[model samples]
Target: MTAGLRALRRRILTPALSSTSLEVRGFRKKNPTAQELLETVGRSFLEGYGRIVEAPDSQAAEPRLEAIPREFRGFAYEGAAMACSIMDALPGSGGRRLSGLLAGRGGAHTYMAYVGIGWAMARLPRMLHPDTEDTDPLLRWLILDGYGFHQAYFHTDRYVRGQHRERKLPWPEDQASYAHRAVDQGIGRALWFVGGTDVDAVLALVDAFPPARRGDLFSGVGLAATYAGGAGADELLRLREGVGAYRPQLLQGSAFAAEAREHAGLTVPHTHLATEVLCGMKPHEAAGVCREQRPGASDRVDMPAYETWRQGIAGALVSEGRS
Candidate 1:
């Protein structure tokens, strides 16, 4: 357990540490030592992801969302834990300010973006090592929640029916063009969430995704928005376009083989729930909106929720200066 915790601290929390403040001359900043920063980031990251918000008791619910499974509700609260964790783990240079900044909409953007990156990296590994339990339950949840259990695609479909059957499936060639753009947008969402206002890095990363393309970039943003819950009318509109474009062409038989159908079913309703939140509805209100759109949609509730949780935890690490 200690080794696992140390690995997570070094690997995950190191990136968010404040390098800018480390070079300052003279008497040193408050709690800005490397060890201090490491501790802060590690604690924050763990606490953020570790927190599992239970369902709220009656009368304390937010106005816009509807009732949902315990896991699906309190995304903002979860986001907060993540942000707090991130702030706690990071160096103190801008620690408190960074922590507060993450509480705003910009923080939400960061949480979702990191979730996307983490999800993309972990997908195939889960298939290859089905026996090894993944450390980030939230990341696992988000991945399965968003994409579903299309393991056959990795194990069989791409090798059999996909465009690049000669090589590995979900390879850079197969999904990177689309997924890369989404990644860029996901980064932008993080910037926005943190209130940084700059998006050059986000766009640059998107451009860097293996099969870069302009149209793909635009679509990626829409897809990211859809995954993050759209936030407003315009975002939702973009999401619709992206989803429509990505649907048959991007997914189809390649990602979803025979047994994978149930997993594929998870996308739409969760998108609906995300859209509700992105459109400014509260968690329960968003859930209501989702239900209104698709009656009996409860079955899709827990498809893969841990991705969001993982993101929340990661963000918390950044905020806490632990990551």
Candidate 2:
């Protein structure tokens, strides 16, 4: 089902994508806004596929993007994450290529780009670190999250990993410590892609989160289930039974996926179909929620922020558990 959806998405997105060649550095527009600058990163990612082959890596200086307001700086990573997705689809060592391109950015941009790497790696889930699988839930997510960051620079900084290794984990001893908020958000959704839905294995790792961290864990589970189109009705139900108390988190993840699909420019059918299949929600209910917060045409989707703020009721239920 996912394969079919991918095919259809490419078809729908192609026409619009084809008309515009990707423009990375040279923004002819004078005084681009923060949102425009961020949006460029995603469009450049699309453009990179089209132009990178023909256009030599432009050593010519890119026009300076204005300072990203502190609150919205994380958006840089979100944009870079979109680029990483494009790079991952390409054959061979794209992470190295990505690192080089991002080298010139601000410190936050560079760090957040690794979180993007985590997001991309979730799609393919190369578990370079063995401990991630057997470790406690918090450690497991961190390792999984770290692996994505690690892979992004694997080709370029393979040996330099030790230089600032401790900085990556603020509390190296604490499994739950993210060291970086971007990584904390990046991990849970990513776990779904990286950790497939082996009910016992998945739940075991999830159970390790304790009640405090389960919301994030549940989001990952929901994302994996929705995209795991093969999860089937029975398996999804089985999953619900095992971790049903966190259904709100699961639906939030589903909505996140749904919003992303729409942002990818796929029609509602493409996005909501997977939700309908994996979420086991009433088709209309799922579709309604999907469209409820769907981005208006050409708007940027701050999915991380969206996922962080879930349906109020879901948030309330999960919050109640917190107290």
For all predicted structures, in order, the TM-scores are: 0.27, 0.42
Q: For each candidate, what is the lDDT?
A: 0.29, 0.40
Model 1: lowest-lDDT 10 consecutive positions: 250-259
- Counting clashing residue pairs in each candidate, in order, gives 61, 1
For model 2, how does the per-residue alpha-carbon lDDT over 1-323 read when each residue is reduced to its tens digit?
35455445445432244222213222122123422432443344333332222222311112212133322333333334334344435556343334444554422243334444443453443432111232222222333443433332232132121212234442234432433332433344433323333455556555654466666557656653553232445556666667766777776666555443333222234234546544544334553455554332331123322333455425443444421
Enumerate residue pairs that collide in model 2: 22-47
Q: Give candidate 2 misplaced runs (Cα > 4 Å).
A: 1-185, 267-274, 277-308, 311-323
Worst 10 residues of 2 by lDDT: 57-66
lDDT of 1 at 299: 18
Please tell me which predicted candidate would have the highest lDDT against the true structure. 2
